[model samples]
Structures are given as structure tokens and as C-alpha cells.
Target: MATAEKDGKIYCRFSRPKSLASMKVEEEDDPSGPTEITIDLSSGKVIFIAVGKTYNGGNDLAEHVEAPVLSSGKVDFSQFKVARGTTMTLLTQLHGVAMVLAWMLFVSFATVEGRYFREGFGSKMVCGLKLWFQMHRVVTMIAGILTAAGFILIFVKVKGLSKNAQAHTYIGIIVMAATCGQIFLGLIRPDATAGWRPKFNWAHRLLGKATHILAAADLILAFRLPMVSPEMRHFGTTVVAVWISVQVVWEVTFEVNKYLQSKSPKVDSIPGKEETKIEEKVIWKDPNGRLQLILCILFVLTIVSCSVATLCAILIF
Candidate 1:
């Protein structure tokens, strides 16, 4: 890295390595010259000049040139060295892991305890209380804690919400708030004896469903951030695809089991009454099929959106 003064204006130049140069330019277009980054210290503006053409400082070079050189005509030579990554980057990865694990646990609880074991397997109680209820409570609490901690780490590293992080920050905040509301509603859930039981149940269910969708969206949006790596983003996409497949399979199985149970014959006997009653109780059901269809459509759209966004981010950086 070198700095120069011409016509009383200061400019900083960065020497491009062979590897980076080859990556940036085709063999035919290669100038066999170093790329120069010019910083206007007075105005705090920076630009890149290569192959006799100038380009504005985009996201890829912004981290290296913007702050240090723009602030004081001084480029930190240390930054040019091959990076081993940063602690903050590792923290962000950990945060993603925690959140993803939490989500997986949540999905397992909803599928196994809520639908499979409860409805298909005809399990009533596991530890005195309903199996689904116990698992849901435990898994959701862990998820909520992980979400909160991950959200806090963003602010801690960035010092404050940066412009690039605005969308992610807002969505994360909304998800956390919704999670709190979900926990509160779950705790205050009413029993069959209460007059407001139906209304309460509907509200709780709706809120929980919305929170899960929003949280998934938030996870996808994270891939757009600059600090995240492309390999990591691709891995995220794979994980999401697997999660979607699991959900689809679980939903189909649940629906099939429910239909079969409804069709099977049932008999209830009562003394002094020559009438038989048939009753079927299903723990999970989509009455109109509209909600399930809409949710599946949304999941597909989200996956496409995240994949496209990840590609765009990779191109930009």
C-alpha cells in the first residue's frame, strides 16, 4: 500500500495481489498492473481505479478503504494482510447456530408431540400434563432465550444499528417482541371451562404461527449482510430446504392419518339407550385447507426469495 500527493491532493494506492487480480479480471482483460484505490482525505470520499477506468467504492472495498483512509489519509497496512476472520464474525456464526438449533427443536416439538404422538399414536399424557404442552413450553423457552441473545450480539458488535443492518435489525426486534407475546399468551391460556377459551386458543395459535414464519424470514435476511460468507449462505439454503421438506412430509402424514381416523367406524355404548355415537378427536386439523395452502406457498416463496437474495449479495460483494 502506498500514498501519493498530486496537485496538492492526497491519494492512497493499494497493490492488488496476483490471486485477487486474476479473480477480478479475465486473462484477456488483465492489465498486468496493480489496482489503485484513491481516497480524497479532505472530502472523506474514496474510489477505485483499474485498467484506466474509475469505479465508485462498492461493498467489497468499502470495509477496507472507507473508514481508515477517508478519516485521515492513512491506510492501515495491517488490513491488507490475509484475514483469519474476526471474533465478531465467529460470534455471529454462533448466534446463527443457536437460533437454527432452537428452530429445529421447535419444529420437532410441534411435529412429534403436537401431531404424531398426540393424534396418530393416541397418547394422552406423558408426565401428568399433555405431552405436546410440556414439550412446546420447554422448547419455546429455549428458542426465546437464543433469539434474544443473538439479537443482542448484533448491537454489541455494530455499536449501533448501521444502515446496512436496518432491515435485519427491525425484523429481529419484531420477532423477539412476537416471541414474548407468544409466551405470555401460552401461559395465560384458558381451559375448556372458561367462556373465552375458543377466542384465547385462536389468538395463541395465530400468534405462534406468525412468529415462526417471521423468524424463518429473519434467518434468510441475515444472509444478505456483508459479514456473512457465501459458503455459509449456501449452507443456510440447504438447511432451509431440508427443514421445508420435513415440514411438508409431516403435514401430509398428519392429514392422511386424520382422514383415515375420520373414516374408521367407532361405537359408543350407553345403558337404557339404543343409540350409538361415533366421535373422532384430531389434535391437528386445517378445517378449510386454505391456511395450510397459504403457509406452504409462503414457505416456497421465502426459499426462492432467500436464494435469489443470496446470489445478488454474492455478486455485489
Candidate 2:
């Protein structure tokens, strides 16, 4: 032992001789793991070294220190182990962080998926949409926090991640990029462009579709791709998809029935009956203009925010 004994405690420190293998991950599968080193705390000596098969497959890349050569340079073989092992602490920390983050993003996606549209268009649904939108923001904030944190954590402990995690990262990166693209489309203004640019609405809507597609892909990668092991990704995806379908059904039904009911204002049909000014007697009872304005504002805000957030995440991380 290289460590010295303190007043009431015993400390053990050890160091290894120097070598080239300790500088990088020697694993056959994952080549990005950390290099091994010998640390002698009491003696205050740290040296680079390499060994046999490690838990991460790192050791297989290098040979252990054999007995010293015939001359003055003798190698130390006494401390060599046939199998190498990984540090449990680092692996645990990395997995814990990534898992937490992935789960958070999943939760956010789930929250906003099934409830917004159907409940957003009704007289009573005004409050419902408000509350749902509030929760949506909450979930979005949580996901952003988790994703940023997880990205850092995974980058640090990358070697320990299974292939699935690696795949998940790639898909996540794409989703992030799509999200940014979606946001970018919103910054356009027709007047500012001197008519040289494409329509902002079209670009924005297209990117939104892209973002939605990428989100689905992200869920798949995060769950089934490589090393990702989230238990709820599939279930959440199914639920969201089903909910979206139902919302579509409801929208179609509402629109078809509404169109049929609105067949009147039939003043247009009686064109030959002398152009009478019926407009003066028409009394509008529904004060829907104000509500329409509010809904429009909400839509615009949601688009701007979701786009900005997705873009920011992709750019920063």
C-alpha cells in the first residue's frame, strides 16, 4: 500500500508504471473509454498504464506489463490482472443522468399530445385548453432541462453506454435539428423580405410537420434503437398517435356538420329576388370575434415558443 495512516484512519494509495495503453479506451466494441492510470496518493506518483480485458472491453487492446527485460529496464508483472474492469461509479452516474433526462422528455411529449386539439376548440374547452397549455409548458420546460443535462452526462460517460444509447443520441440529434429548422421558418416576415422569400406560413407549417416526424423517430430510437431502454416510449407513442387520430375524427365530424348547418345565409341563393338590403336588418348574436382573436394569439404564441425552444436545444447541445 502506498497510502499513509492518519490519526484515526487508514488510507491506501497505489500507482502503476508508465505506458501508452492508458491514454485511451482499449475496448474492442467501444473505443472512446478512458485511459487507465496508476495513482500513488502517499507517494504522489501517477503513471500511465494498460492491461488485459476490462469490463468495458478496454483492456483487450493492450498487453499487461510483463517481467522486466534482460537489461536494466525490468517490467512489473506482479500486479497485472487477466481481466480488466470498469469503474462502477462512472457508469452508474452516467446512466442515471441520461435515463432521468430521456424520461423527462418522454413525459413532456406525452403531456401535450392527446389533449390539446379536441379540448381547445369549445366554449367550455377554453378553460380546458388554458389549463392544458399551462401543463404543456411545464412539461416542455422539464424536458428542456433534462435533455440539456442528459446530453452533458452522456457525453462524459459515453463509453459505458450500450449501442442503443448511441443510436438514441443520433436520433435525438436529428429531432433537435428538425426542431430548430421548424423554429427558423417562423422568423420570416413577408414585408421584410421584399417579396424575395418564400411564404412564412408555408415554411413554418412544413417544418412543423418535419418536427412531428422526427419526434416520432426520436421516440423510437430512444426506446428501441440501440442502448436506450426507456420502458414507456412505445406506450407513450401509441397513446399519442391514437389520441391524434381521435382528434382528427372529431375535427372532421365537427367541420362536416358545421358546413351543413351553415347552408343558409342563403341570401346568395335568392339572387333574382331584387337586390334588397338585408344586411341592414341582420343581427349578429355571437360575439365570437374576440374569442377568435384570443385563439389566434394563442396559436401564434405556441408556434413561436415551441420553435424557439427546439432550435435552442439543437444549437446549444
Residue-by-residue lDDT tens digits, candidate 2, 125-235 = 334445554554465546545555655565666554455445557766665565445435434435555665556646654655455555545544433432212323344
Reference-based TM-score of each model? 0.56, 0.36
lDDT of 1 by residue, 93-173 (tens): 456655665554454345334444443223567788776567666767787787778777767767777755557678878
Q: In model 2, which regions exceed 4 Å deviation?
A: 1-150, 159-167, 185-198, 226-317
Task: Report the error of model 2 at residue 111, Å.
Answer: 12
Clashing pairs in 1: none
TM-score of 1: 0.56
Q: What TM-score does prediction 2 earn? A: 0.36
Model 2 poorest ten-residue lDDT run: 65-74
lDDT of each: 0.55, 0.43
How big is the positional error of residue 168 in model 2, measured in Å on the Cα after superposition? 3.3
